[model samples]
Target: MNNKLSLKNINVKYGESLALKSINLDIYKGEFVVLLGSSGAGKSTLLRTINQLNPLTSGELDFFDLGKIRNKKDLQNLRKKTGMIFQQHQLIERNTVFQNVLTGRLGFHSLLRSILPLPKFDQELALDCIDRVNLLDKALVKVKELSGGQQQRVGIARALAQNPSLILADEPIASLDPKTSHQVLSMLKDICKKDNISALTSLHQVDFAKEYGDRIIGLSHGKIVFNGKSDQLSDEILKNIYSSSTITEETNFTSNEVVMV
Candidate 1:
């Protein structure tokens, strides 16, 4: 199968520290892949690397049909083709849910168009995305008025409004309760399946990843320790991924990640 995003020997460094080491990954259309690892294992770096939010130290990157992104237009096109969901809701607390969702379309708008009011069709698209996340009831309400889970739903809707073919989510549910986390992740996976959008999500909960992902990629010490189907994950494999054992350190790290590659 042709991949939507391909990375070859990808490496990322934060100052002198290596965040990602010699990573090779390929994601097919509509696959929900989970990334698993303790904090500092480079899950965040991997996700950021996909959208060029984190520059590669050295590597080849490609988006299907778009080829290697070597120019500004290519990079801009990449951004427009991919969506992002942050760990926190990252919504403008004062903005209404619908308004926040509209921000997702700014990449496609001219500067003047962005500053001016959005067109009627764009407004309708934002409303549809909001409805996709079951947030239509809160469309006119300020983001601050919603619960934590609701705010995260708004974030998802914002990404949907971008109409992206790929989504990069960095531990998007790290702050929610167990029930809420499951609900949010389920909604995200369902949307991806329905839209045939490839999703690369970093998550902390192993069980949740198993339930939602078509495949799982586990990292340790900034290197891939395991990459296979979710059902293929064994405790021994997780042990290898989490590494030579640092319990307290792992406790401080983030959530699970699943991807279909």
Candidate 2:
């Protein structure tokens, strides 16, 4: 199968500290892949490297039909085609839901054009995205007025407005309660399946990862220790992934600040 995103011998460094080491990963069309790891295990770093948010120390990134990401223009095109969902919801609290979602379409317009009123098509698309997440009624409401789950749904709609071929969700549900997390993940998975968009999501909850992920990847100290179907993620592997970290079988932990890739 053709990959939506491919990373080969990827490495990322923050100054002298290495965050990702010779990592290799691939995401295919419509695939829902969950990333599991303890804090500082490199899940976030790996995701950021794919869209060039974290500059690679050495590696090659190939995006669907876009060839290798080797230059500034390639990076720009990659960003336009990719959608990102963050843990904090990342919405403008003062802006209406529709307004926040509309920002996703700005990538397609020139800088000057983005500042002006968006075309009718973009406006309609933003509404459609809101509807996709069952937030049509909340479109006119300020983002701050919504519940945590609703705010995350708005974030999903914003990403959907990009009409992306691939989505990268970095701990998208870390802040919500268990019930709300389930609702958000269910909505996100259903939407991606229906749209046939590939997704890579990071999570601390093992149960949720097993439930929602078609495939699961385990990260340990900046390296991938396991990558397989969810059913194949045995307990032995889980121990190896979180052994030295604070994460436990029953614990759902959260850490780190997130950014769009």
Ten contiguous residues minimizing lDDT sum, candidate 2: 252-261
Q: Assess candidate 1 and give its TM-score to the true structure.
A: 0.92
lDDT of 2 by residue, 1-261 (tens): 345688999989888988998899888889999999878899999888888888899989999888888899999999988899999988899999999999999999999999899999999999999999999998999999999999999989998999998889999989998888999999999999999999999998888898899999999889999999878877678777876565445543222221111
Candidate 1: stretches off by over 4 Å: 1-3, 244-261
Clashes of each: 14, 0
RMSD of each: 4.2, 4.3
lDDT per model vs. reference: 0.87, 0.88
Stretches off by above 4 angstroms in model 2 are: 246-261
Instruction: Give the Å error, residue 194, model 1.
Output: 0.6
Model 1: how large is the Cα RMSD against the reference?
Answer: 4.2
Q: Write the per-residue lDDT of candidate 1 for residues 115-219, one digit (tens) a residue.
A: 999999889999999999998999999999999999999999999989898988998998998899989999999999999999999987888888888999999
